[model samples]
Target: MNYSLFAKVFVAVIVIQSFIILIGGQLNIIRVDRLIQQREYEYDRKDMLVVQDAYNHKLKQIRTNVLSLFFDSTQSESILEKIKRYKGTTKAEDLTLQAEIQQFLQSMAYTDESIRSILFVRNSDEQKFAFVRYFDPSLLPNFESMISLKEDEFVKVYPVDASPTKQVLIFILKVNDPNTVGMKQTVGNLVVSIDTGFLQIEGDPLHADSIIELKNSNGTIRMSGNSFAADISQIDLDARKHDSKDYFVTQVDNTVDDMVFTMLISKKQLKQSLFAMKKNQWMTIVAIVFLNVFIAFYISRALSKRVNTVTRNMRKYTPGEFVNPILIQKQDEFTVLEETYNQLILKLSEFIQKEYVMEIKSKEAELQLLHSQVNPHFLSNMLEILRMQAIKENNLNLSDTIYQLSEIFRWNIRNKETVVTLYEELYYIEYYLKLQQFRFPKLQFRIVLPQNLQNQRIVKFSVQPIVENVFKHAMNKGKETDIHIQVIEAYDSIRVSVKDNGKGMVADDLDLLILKMQKPLADTKDTPSVGLMNVHARLQLIFGEPHGLEVQSQIGEGTKVILHIPKNEVGP
Candidate 1:
């Protein structure tokens, strides 16, 4: 073996494999980095939603308080009576009334922060002039549009001078009086401020930078607050454009569609961490590339040598030649490959022999065609004519004999199969016996066939020659010759015997007959004596030598031809 070529090719393959793995590792690292960043973005978006949900929850709490006060008829009536009683009181009396109003405000303060500011508003200067002059009306923003002069509830945005630098979210509520239920009369307006800052601060622990901003439909900021910002709108905008972090917006329905609540992540730390992750991932990828290269090189070198040896052996193996021994130097995957290849080589030789056998059979069939002895159509016509003549003479026995002879000639000429059933062989003998009876009706013939013989098959025309031999030789001189055909079924064989009380041969003559059957004699014309040769030849062809015909005789007594046929040869 040329180790040098194998070593050089193996080294080159290893190098190429290592290079491919290194490139693949680099691409994998980039993909992993991007995937991590995407996951972080998704997580941050969920966090922003959580923060916005908390803000909405706090606002819902505030709205609940406002609804309770708006629906409280008794408290509303009290506030209305105070406004009516103190409308035209003196400054000193109004001072006493202011004390009562302060106490009333204190009682309602716990309901919500928005409910503490309440004032009566009237356009009339003379009727309610004294109480109106005590407070700075110019300081309060417009509440006339909000007070339901006809019904009892209206909402208005009133800019407060208390926080004139910014803005206040206020709602105006009126208490209804039974006497003025269907009249256009306004007594006072209830004012309250929605604390946007407290809402954003509710869930600050979950959000990195929590912001809540209420904006009007026109995009003007109505309320803005955060743990860190007087103005959260800019940070909120940044959160929207980059929605890499979580951000969400909701509508505040208390004020017309005028207000929207937004919660957003407004810090850079979360993104900074993700960026640092990419840097660390690049460094990790470098180390991974080196490790993969080392592994790919080692694995490729080991795998290629074994694979190449199996390939060479497979390519060199040829059918119809003895297979070479595969030298397995290592007991691993290589050993399996070598063993499988060896099995394939052995199987190839067997297939070749089977194909060759089929080829020889094809050639032998051609030879049988050239050696045919009789004209089939002539033989058939002769047998049929003989059968008809025998029938006209009232000789049914002779007619059946001719029919049997025709069947024998037909079976032999066709030679459709090498084997026939034992029943078929018996039928052949029946015709031969009928012919013998016609020749000498005084000859008594008895046939005893075992029932088991019907299921068994034997070589074609097996019994014809033995029966023919008895008719020809034994019946030549006897006046009352008896022929007995007995078929006995043994354990693994069927025994067929034909016995005749005629002039039997001596031992020496029997031996000579057996020898002649074993080997062909020179004269074909005199060869049909017992047709023992022909019968023996066919038995050997169908079954084998150990199962051919046997003959026994005693001079001046009888002769018996015993055929031992193997039962296994019948069906299979």
Candidate 2:
């Protein structure tokens, strides 16, 4: 073949390959996205497994320490009987018990945040000590009232409060102390509330992706290993349908109760693992494509420069300053390309100018979209100031709360419109609460987020404002306030809850608010309450009518707001 014709054929082949490569690159990108999701699931699952193991180990440790204390050679039924029988109405015995309990707790590596209370109830007089490094005399209760009557033999019981001031696991032991053991008798019950505050993965970076739970033989969740809501009952029910290894069963402590032990890893780890695998694959493909494009461009440019020289001379044949137009000696594809390039450029310029005018004219129609025009720079500064003030006033909690709030806003501004993994959202909430807590230090707030939700993606700020509202209206005004925030991840959808112990709204207030929250600004004469209205509007925009804010509140009791949003918003 002629060299020129061969050159043309080579260029055509290169162009075709480029198009094919582009399609393949996009396909690889798609594959990588799916793989990354899989890896994320896997990582999350593995993390959950690790967390479960660690938690069970800790629980076992607590159980061992408590049992050992009762079963020690120094402790006996007679000794325990004497201690119970010798108790006086005066706070003297209570003080002795408190000292012993505190000494035991400290020796056993139990921090104040972990052991909320240690109480010893006697037959004649009741005395106990409740200390978390500090004293809580009111937490002492009658040992007889809290005892389990289900079994006749000496047994250890883990009792969750009917209404826990905080999410914690409480362990109760009824065994012989030294005094009672000497008399060959078992008398008083030793009750210790192992506050789960210490159990929370406070400084752990991966806490959001981890989960732990303790389950009974009946599949009821006796106490959770982590701060997550108990789903061990469901795990047991679901496990029955599958083989043993694949199923979720409670990790066993055969020494204590011989409960079947198993841990189903969070599926998020699997997802993460798969995602990493695909990321590697796509990254390799991208690198290859990029190299191919670079080589192709270099070769094409060399050839184009030669052709341009010939064309330039032909155009300048009669030129001094202004050059003569190119007179083609032959008609071919290059001639067609030259003609089309000039015409396309002309048309593109015209189109750009037209679009510019149209964009300005359409600005009026886009007033609503302008809500996204918030300047993060200004907001960040304000948050810093708020945090500093909280710290200066001995409001470390409030300072942390402000910091969290800033983080939520930062994430919102920085990661706009991108589908965030559920773990990411939890992180945002954790920080948001740090800021809110500074404002309401007396309020009790706990989050029971799903451990396996790393695979799921949600709209940003999905659960934030509902939590904000709890503090704004209900939590800040009251003393001894409480709120339980839980995020339940289901197969089809995710449920977000913000339940508060505060003065709640009446039915008519609900009626007026719900309607206003849902309606557009034009429809409503006035804005619904700030936080609620913004949350309602944002959720409506993202999830549409299928998911919106639902509030349940009774005047004297409290408020519970539930947000239900679909799990699968985008295809992998």
Query: Once superposed on the true structure, which residue ranges of model 2 sit more than 4 Å away at CA?
Result: 1-375, 378-406, 476-478, 517-530, 569-572
lDDT of 2 by residue, 1-572 (tens): 45798899998987887678667866876787667545644554454455455446655665565555544365453223334544444588755654555565454545444665555554334444333443332353643444543445454544343242344445555555455446345455555555544434532313432334444432223333343344433444344425433323224344545333233444444456556755575466568879999999997995586479556655544412333333445566567755654455456655665466445433632442355446675788899998999889999866776777787667766764535777777777777666555666775678787666555666666576677677667753547777787878766678878888887899999888887776643232222223666556545555666776788899979999987777763445
lDDT of each candidate versus the true structure: 0.59, 0.57
Instruction: Please report the candidate that would top lDDT against the real structure.
Output: 1
Could you give candidate 1's per-residue lDDT for residues 1-572 as a string of tens digits?
Answer: 55798899998987887677657766876787578556644654454555456545544554444344323465544544554666555688776665666555455554544333434453344122112212233344443444434453344443332342343444444433435857346544444444334433554433535544445532344333334355444454533755644433332333333444444444465556656765565466567879899999988997887788778877777667776766667787668877887777777886787567445544554555445445665788899999999999999877887887787677667665557777766766776676666778787888887766676777666687787777678664746888888888888778888898888998898999888877622233332223777677556645666787788898888899888788854554
Error of 2 at 269 (Å): 90
What TM-score would every model get versus the actual structure? 0.33, 0.31
Tell me how many residue pairs clash in candidate 1. Answer: 2
Whole-model lDDT for model 2 versus the true structure?
0.57
The positional error of residue 108 in candidate 2, measured at the CA in angstroms, is 71
Q: Give the least accurate 10-residue stretch of model 1, judged by summed lDDT.
A: 126-135
In model 2, how large is the Cα lDDT of residue 8? 92
